[model samples]
Target: MPSRSLTDPPRIAFAGTPEFAARALEALIGFDCDIPLVLTQPDRPAGRGMKLTPSPVKACALAHGLTVDQPDTLKTPELRAPLVEAAPDLLVVVAYGMLLPRAVLDIPRLGCINIHASLLPRWRGAAPIQRAIEAGDARTGITLMQMDIGLDTGPMLAEHVVDITDIDTTATLHDRLAEAGARLLIDTLPDLLAGRVTPRAQPDHGACYAAKIGKTEAALDFRRSASELGRRLRAFDPFPGGLMSVDGTPIKLWRAEVLAEPGAPGLISRVDDQGVVIGCGAGSLCITELQKAGGRRLPVAEFLRGHALAAGQQAQLPG
Candidate 1:
């Protein structure tokens, strides 16, 4: 909705939270886009100190001297005033966390564009990075789409596909996708602003919600196949993690590999330098990295030095 010609640079407003969003903002700044204001969620208590922490987006905005706004909700007219006054031509929203009401969406002339972690219509909600890996998806990518009222249901503008390796964890995949999204947005901005890009409706099929991840789902279930368990172990790393209880001592699994051999479920078939091999329903898993409740993740050899886990021991699994 900028008054200037379509080829001219339009005033872009940005909204986002977290490190993922911060990366995109950094890209926009690097591109020398005319960003007048940044919108992010309010500061929240974080870390063991429970001190108020600025969202990554806000921190980046302040560092770059960009005007920042934090509102509890944009549903009210008063809360949406700053955005209205900014009069941005287009709003680029990443993982802003808060939903934009209809009023806020209509403020910009060209509406808003979102940078999503997964290819739209696939993982369409929070925690897409973890869900894709947990679901054993072979490939995942970033989707830049127009924003609508529905959850990630808007038409897609473009996408950058990223191959999912067998060993990728949510933490690892998240970094890759975050950078990819930044690059994709930069590459597509000119065409999008110039009206050279067309929005294509997402397919009706292949739709699924990526529900937010919770700590409760971190426990490792030996009843599942080794491959499934292995994927989960990698997916949950640096988060709730793959939990297992041995001799009543809870441990978090960081890295693992599936094996063809089988033994009684929850049974430990081997424990040596390779890993702590544990049996599952279909096969076995070699757990290479582990952490204690309050300790750091360490290689199996280092973990063994502090804990006494023998091959005959059984890993406690949920009944």
Candidate 2:
């Protein structure tokens, strides 16, 4: 392949879907590259009204007046035709939601590069951001990798670590990682286009998969240790949301902290204006914020004013 001049920006075809992906697209737009086409998922019903909503990448592409394609699947010959004809220098994919086949992968001269959320070889599937927090990892970060057929088994081009804080939720962590991923992608693009960055194979050992988060997984089990449950609550927040049942009434827990106290699992050992302290199998957690079914999330004092939960009440995972 002939090397393009350093002054020339590489032609790029971007594939992405969500806000995380959109952020990368946004970063690329600010770069000197030419994004001729953007491939995203088809519009789907979303939110309370169930209105047809475009993927964040599609919206961003449209706003920038770039051509966009929302193919249900990229495996079709017809869909792959445009990509082949475009003959892009590189294919940049981030959170595109669908796997790319070999036919599509071969279209780009420079090949495909992906911006994945977690450090390569760890938390390497659908829900990396949430999985890292749930597992209580002290740090997680973005990995720019050369795309291959395997699931995030691609060789690493660049990586940057971001620390996970005590109060960080999935939502907050996601945003921070999105920006980090964006910046990292832009920084790496120059070296990648210039052929200065070399791909490194990810280590086979100590690798783990981050399976997608399920709504059912959000059901809080107080029978577990308070520290574990507290992390789970933060990890699942602003997504499926952490759920629990207190005295047979359904509730969603938004924020909690381990209290270093012990009592019978599922028992409400104390309740005051500060919060509701619930006993776990090993320790206790002070639920600082919660919401009743069909109600907005409220502080412990506000929630207590409307629906009283006194000491001796039990909190458990919903059946």
Candidate 3:
């Protein structure tokens, strides 16, 4: 281990990717500790032009003048050697896409701890934020846990819950969780380093996986209940956005509200300055915000000003 006096704050090595992880890294920068290194996913092609983009965590680490490593796999000895050489007292992970093998996990004196986006044993997988909103969960939060071999089946250190509001989309919920998690991590670290906090094994009950959201799931099905479809529109915001075919032209639904009106599913029941009321199997949905293919997102009143979608028309599911 790197030479250090007991009075010094713990030496930390952080590994993470994405904006959520970057937020936690930002919090750590303000702490009274030595951050030996930061490990983030490698840059990848993105956007309409497909230009190479560095991950949010990598960019943040660089801005803070911290050493950064973007290895393809940490399991290999050559790659793992540098981490062991750093001799971090603790390893902090947040949304790191790749799993750390047992060899690497054993390197840190205090072992690896993760700031997961969901309560332990619930929504434990790749896409907790999106999964919670998609599942219509009333609430979700962050969990600080001791990492192990199993997927998020680790012992819990701390947890903080946040309520899910009606207006909350995936984008909104994600920001809340990120901030809440950052605060929780900072508060828990001191206790953790002093051996005051005890790790509790997570119960086997209430386990569910939050699988990665697929592009295919974007296609909206009017056959489902309006309430469920409305939730989906909020869940998939700024992602594979909720999709529907209007008179054979593809349109994206951004925000919607359920209505009590009943009519044939998929058929347009009403079109006014208010919104587009589309029928569902159970009830109806008022699509207040929408966007046509190759057009800007607009309120229903503005969308109807140019392109026309009237009653008797239908929004069809893409095949």
Candidate 4:
């Protein structure tokens, strides 16, 4: 690619879905980037009414009166034509939820770049934020990468590191990473377009794919350690949630603390205003925040007011 004059703003095409990508698009608009086209997934049914709703990226584009396209796939020449016609110097992909095959990748002048949620070549696939937390990693970061045919096996343009806190859930970590990526993209874009920065290849070692989180995995298995169970609750919060069943009624666990006191695994050792203390294989887990199925999440104190839990009761995986 030819070096760009710093005075000339590059024509960029944006592709993404969900709020994470929307944040980056918003940043670009604020920066006055010359974005010619925006691509997002097609509208899908959402909420209780199952009404068709545009993705967050699409909504942002429309609100700004930018040209927006929702292509189901980019495999066909027809579907990829709009991107080619835009003549973009760069294509920024952020959580777009669609794979861009090789044909689509060659359209940009400076080439396609991705803003990934985790530090590559670690946690390289879907659900990186939650997986990092679940795996008890002390740090997770945003990687700005040069896109390749291989999944996230791309050369790094830049990266911004963010530390993970013990209390962080997927929701909290996601928000932080989104903002970091947006900042990193704008900061690096000027130099990148001017051909001032080199793309560093990712190492072949220590790569891991983050498989998508499944609702079935939310069922808390007390056979695990207290720390593991606590992390699971935090990792899955604001989604499927950590599940525990008492007398066939499924309760979702939102926040928990690992404790030293222990009993038989899956046995409820104590039930009080403090919280519900249940035994794991190695330690005890204190359920601090929880909710009944179809109910709002509540503190343990508030939850116990309307529910019955007793010491020595066995907690089972939700069926």
* Candidates' C-alpha lDDT: 0.91, 0.91, 0.92, 0.92
* Residue-by-residue lDDT tens digits, candidate 3, 1-319: 6467889877899999999999999999999998999999989999889998999999999999999999989878999988988889999999989998999899999999999999879999998888888888999999999999989998999999998998899999999999999999999999999899999999879999999899999999999999889888888987878899987798888989899888789999899989899999889999999898888899999999988999999899975
Q: Which stretches of model 1 miss by more than 4 angstroms?
A: 1-8
Residue-by-residue lDDT tens digits, candidate 4, 1-319: 3556867777899999999999999998987568889999999999989999999999999999999999999999999888888889899999999988998888998899999999999999989999999999999999999999989998999999999999999999999999999999999988998899899999889899998899899999999899999998888977879888998989888998899887799999999999999999989999989899778999999999998889989999887
Write down the RMSD of all candidates, one decimal each.
2.0, 2.1, 1.2, 2.3
Give, for candidate 3, the lowest lDDT window spanning 10 residues.
1-10
Off by over 4 Å in 3: none
Off by over 4 Å in 2: 1-8
Give the TM-score (vs. native) of candidate 2.
Answer: 0.96
Which of 2 and 3 is the better model by TM-score? 3
In model 4, state the lDDT of residue 7.
76
Q: Kindly give the number of clashing pairs for every candidate.
A: 0, 0, 0, 0
Query: Number of clashes in model 3?
Result: 0
lDDT of 1 at 141: 99
